[model samples]
Target: MVEVADTAVRAGLSGPRHPADPARRREARAGYGLMSPALLLMVAVLALPLAALIVLSFWTQSGFTLDRTFTLANYWRLIAPSDREVEWMGLTFRLAYPVPAILIIKSLVMSLTATVAVILLAYPMAYFLAFRVHRNKAAWIILLTVPFWTSYLLRVFSWKVVLGYNGAINSGLMSLGIIDAPLEFLLYNPAAVTITLAHSWVSFIVLPIYVSLEKIDRSMLEAASDLGDSKWKRFRRITLPLSMPGTISAALLVFIPTVGDYVTPELVGGPGGTMIGSLVQQLFTKQNNAPLGAAVSLVMMLIIGAMVLIFLTLIGYWRMRARRAA
Candidate 1:
């Protein structure tokens, strides 16, 4: 009876005593309460519009009235290839290729080209600033962002001024007797579009890369040097690996938006340089086909998402290999 009483007393005293349970529960409740406003705002702002976009993609637009009838015609128009042609200003043009594929391909090519150009130019500049500029780094950073303070439209237009006939390059060349007349091919071309995009987004690449390189451990480089590694070798092995995060960031920042850039192409792309974005805009504004536009936009988004996934996967593989090799 004494042993049983002692066991009972011990079990009663040690019965799953959870300290601060009430306090933890209250803290969790407060955190959730604090997050509720932002969550509600996101649902109202982002989620609703996205849902509406998806719904709109299913409905057909006849004249100005959106038909409640659902159809897959819009998406079919994008993927199903056929002999499509257009006539404008009494000029008939026949396309042997699919219309949607051409527009999407042009956007991908232009975006990839511009992203490469921006990173190539930005990496060197970032390296210089991070390694060489011991003083006035703040001033340099401020100056780097100065171009962005101006409007994006203005920046694109500025490129127009530089590339247009009788503009800076042509005028200078003519003045030096290198050419008799202004070069007409400088503007309204894919190269011009690519160059303009590169200049426009270079600051993005430079700033991120500089930040990444700055965070790299100098000790690693010193140890490499101590081991008789050449400057190029040290940079190739250590610095490049470390700076990849910034490089990838810069690439994504430059690539994604450039794919859908309508304004730049509309202003300077001419007929040959028109992108998928231009087509989507035309569908919405000129063609009065909101449903088709929504479908196209969704398709573009899906393609871009896929491209991004592939790129990130490749980058991850490369990083893993580099780490293992090191």
Candidate 2:
């Protein structure tokens, strides 16, 4: 009896296997295996390059060759009080202790101006497309995106011709007797750079805002109207506030790129149009100073990062407040 009981107990102790556990384990393995390729690609494409840049930014270089030694000289040089002008590739460069400061301010101003202009221009256009022009919405959206098919370089260069001294505006003004001489202010200035960048990136700002605005429920607006809200009041209290997310997102998209743009400044910005990006390019290509260039790039990255963080924080705070109020 005892021997039989022991055998039975042992058999009972060997519990039934869980089919779900093995199935779950297999599924998890398959999911990870599928994702591994994409994960590796991301690491190779983005992570590795970013890590290399960070490392290179700290390394000293001589005549395009990097030194293995680590040094703080690159960062220190940013604020080095030197009256001696650094000349590279026949262009004389002076270190203004305040150059970085000025660059940040200028970049922000230009970006803000461009963002505001895009929002103002895009809002009405987007609204018209979303609410009023529903018959051919897809066609209109395609038309809006058609500019992207053209080469960005060509489009920007075309502006040079349009805004040149002997260009379209000058000819038109002359034909109409609006001016006796060609206006020099038409191109190669900060204003020209701002205008060109705004035109180039207008679509980026418009598309996102349009999508967001289009998603807004018309019933909400109708409810506001039914609740005795005036047209202006409805827009102010409802339409504008609800559209804040799109506006904020558009501002971010425009501001981030415009702040780092070198091409616009080089092409349209004549004398006083040099930004931090131009400085970085000079360091890398002209001066053959990779460390210094890296430092500048890192600084620019930090500035943009800070701006993004602040914008996100503000958005979060506003969202929380809005939710609480609701």
Candidate 3:
């Protein structure tokens, strides 16, 4: 009789028509219904435009006439080998169309340089904010963000003024008898673009790193100290790993958007520093090749996506190795 009662109870609990199932189903339905609007908005805002871009990439445009018929000529032109060869870092690439290839390489180098600079510069400030500052921390954060409140254009222009031949640096140096002529190399080059981008994005990168560092548990550090670990060792073994999520977030935040940034490159890049974004703009407007422009944009997006995926994969592998060692 006891066995029979147990079997019956088990069946009731696992049955298809369980008593609480209806309420659970209703709750799930309500949750999905609540999320439907946001999902729709994302689809409308992001997905639709991306789909259009992809479709346009496959079409061909010529002389104010757009052909909806699918063709791969534009992409082929980008990918096919040409007679000219360029060597870099022990590798040679035969670029069919050198403009896109050169611009893409230039943009990547500039973006990476800027990202590294931002991380290096922001980390110390963020570390100070997280661990050093005790009182009026909010005021410090506000001060850090004050430069960002101005128009981004204004900020870039400010850098141009500081870096330009007749700008502040040259004038100050000239006044102080540090130099006779204005420095021509200070502006209108890759370095100038890199500097402008780094300064422009540093404040935005700091908060994420600061948040990550701030979220670290102090007890862990205390315990490490009690265990005879030096400050450097404790940070390497504890704080750094814990803060990586924010650092990685900060890196991605700067790297991805800056790769496509046309404004900084336009203002400071000049002819030598022209990025792929400027090329895309020219293709779409002056060159009147919308299809080719779309193809280049898609390729840039793909390259960014691939790089991000690889970065995440490496981070995951490192985390796994760390866990295993622990």
Pick by TM-score: which candidate is best?
3
Query: Candidate 2 at residue 322, lDDT?
Result: 81
Clashing pairs in 1: none
Compare candidates 2 and 3 on TM-score and give the better one.
3
Candidate 2 lDDT, 99-166, residue by residue in tens = 66466567777777877787788888787787788697899999998889998888889899999998
Each prediction's whole-model lDDT (CA): 0.85, 0.80, 0.90
For all predicted structures, in order, the TM-scores are: 0.85, 0.82, 0.89
- Misplaced by over 4 Å in model 3 are 1-21, 86-92
Candidate 1: list runs displaced more than 4 Å.
1-41, 83-97, 321-326
Best by lDDT: 3
Q: What are the clashing pairs of model 3? A: none
Model 1: worst 10 consecutive residues (lDDT sum): 88-97
Report clash pairs, candidate 2. none
Ranking by lDDT: 3, 1, 2
Residue 81's lDDT within candidate 1 is 46
